[model samples]
Target: MRPITAIGFDADDTLWQNEQYYRLTEQSFVDLLGEFAEGAHITERLLEAEKRNLAYYGFGIKGFTLSMIETAIEITGGQVSTDTIAEILEIGRNLLRHPVEKLPHVEETLEALNGEYLLVLITKGDLFDQERKLAQSGLGDFFDAVEIVSDKNATTYRRIFSKLADGPERAMMVGNSLKSDIVPAIAAGSYGVFIPHALTWVVEHVEPPTDAPRFRQIEHLGQLGSVIEAIKAA
Candidate 1:
């Protein structure tokens, strides 16, 4: 692996606790609709709705809330009450108000690499929601740039790198999702670093590519500094 001058980090599960909120809200959703169907059935249907609505609503709490309401309507055959719908909206609002909890070593790792590299936060989700999280995270000042993109793809990665002096060949992407963060950045000629998170959303998943030319996997964010050191040495 070659040295990277610019490093992009994915937000959400990579830096802070995010998906756990979704999971918790989902459980609440199931309980709210307990009279309509079983928790397992509601969960399965909600997942399906979320996947189906991805294109329309994009990603984040707003979309998830809509999907939950849709699923409630579908499963209950329109028997879902207005009060339940209001409760679903409240659930979403509660998610947006959820406190940002930085994962282990997030602040320390960022501090370690603070002035050593050009750090950019490349995350995809609702613009307002992402901005809110960043503001709440207290790690915003560590980043040289912040990009809240509509999607993360090879073309998107290339586009982001194109504006940088070092370009994609001298950049690296670190994130939890194999499909969004790892594969696309690797395909775009940057080193892709995968930091697996246990509570990743199902829709963000894909098998890690077997033939990725420049890829690294570390157990935790605390190991990122060492990984970068090894890359520089290589």
Candidate 2:
């Protein structure tokens, strides 16, 4: 029941559009390899490649692009042509260059809470891509700090909260992913707020910690103020 002081936000799909582009590119990937396998099989293999390559490539468009190529090679039994590989690379480049579209209520919510709380952007992705997206979003200045990390975990939340605020007890982490944004933050002793997005990566999906006292779910960023107030009152 500690009063929330610092607020951590997730960038992809939380503040703006991200996963939709990935989904689109993934469909493109599936189509490019349609000769080798069915769309569902291609998609499944791509997901497997992505999961296997996480430790190798981490996250973001670069990893996704590589996974597409890997899946192509796997599906085609190493007979996939270089032309298809080039096309997959172009798909990734397009993803990197896609426009950053802010979600509704993102700016107003940040503007409303900016000076009142220590607002930090804690996200997981390729460092360069994340930086580019943040700069392009034009929402960078609203944050007191920006953390583009390799992954999100309880230890990561604990370190960030302790370094940026009055520790995890006074911090609240908000985002769409139950796995990265909510459970870990709650485990770190911070208030965890869920703001669901229409498209979330399969890897990021997990069961919500509804029974956790520090866990909360809001319809959107616009409702965040009320949740904060409720937490404060509690």
Candidate 3:
């Protein structure tokens, strides 16, 4: 394993309690549409709507809000009421205003690695919302840069690492999603560290790439220092 000179951190679940807020908003959507369908059915439809709208609206609370409205209309056969629509919009607004809760050891781990290696925050979402969370996180000073991208893919990782380090071989990406964070980074020739989250969004789900040469999995952010040390020792 080549020693990692630059490290990229995925902002959402890797650094803070992101998915849980989305999950709470999802439950709120189900409750709002309880009259039209069961909670499980509503949840399923919402996920479908989110996936369907991903390309058109991209990701974030705004897209999610629009999808919920669309799902409500579809579930109720276009007869969904104005008041319900208003409530759903309120749910989204509340989510936007929700407090950011940094996960365990996030600050400590980042502090440990700061200045020793290049640190960049690579997160994909609505720019405004992501920026808001970063400001709220108060860990902004630790990162050498912040990238709020439209997507995460092999090409994107390669481009980012090219500028951030000597090469992809000297870069490492740590995040919760295998599809977005691990597999693509590994494919781009960077090391990928998987830190699983209990409530990952379905859209981000993929089997861990245990066979990948550049892949590593740690249970949480608290273990990140050890992973970095192991990579450095190699």
User: Which has the greatest TM-score?
Assistant: 2
Look at candidate 1 and tell me the lDDT of residue 52.
95
Candidate 2: stretches off by over 4 Å: none
Question: How high a TM-score does candidate 2 get?
Answer: 0.98
lDDT of 1 by residue, 1-234 (tens): 346888999999999999999999999999999988899999999999999999999888888999999999999998889999999999989998999999999999999888888899999988898999999999999999998888899998998877853889999999999989999999999999999999988887899876776988999999998888887887
| Sliding window of 10 residues with minimal summed lDDT for model 2 | 1-10
Model 1 regions more than 4 Å off:
none
Query: Count of backbone clashes for each model?
Result: 0, 0, 0
Clashing pairs in 3: none
Q: Is candidate 1 or candidate 2 better by lDDT?
A: 2
lDDT of 3 by residue, 153-211 (tens): 99989999898776788899999999999999999999999999899888889888899
Question: lDDT tens string, model 2, 30-116?
Answer: 888888899999999889999999999998888888998888999999999989989999988999899999999999999999999
lDDT of 2 at 97: 90
lDDT for every model? Answer: 0.91, 0.93, 0.91
CA shift of 21, model 2, Å: 0.2
For model 1, give the 10-residue run with minimal summed lDDT: 159-168
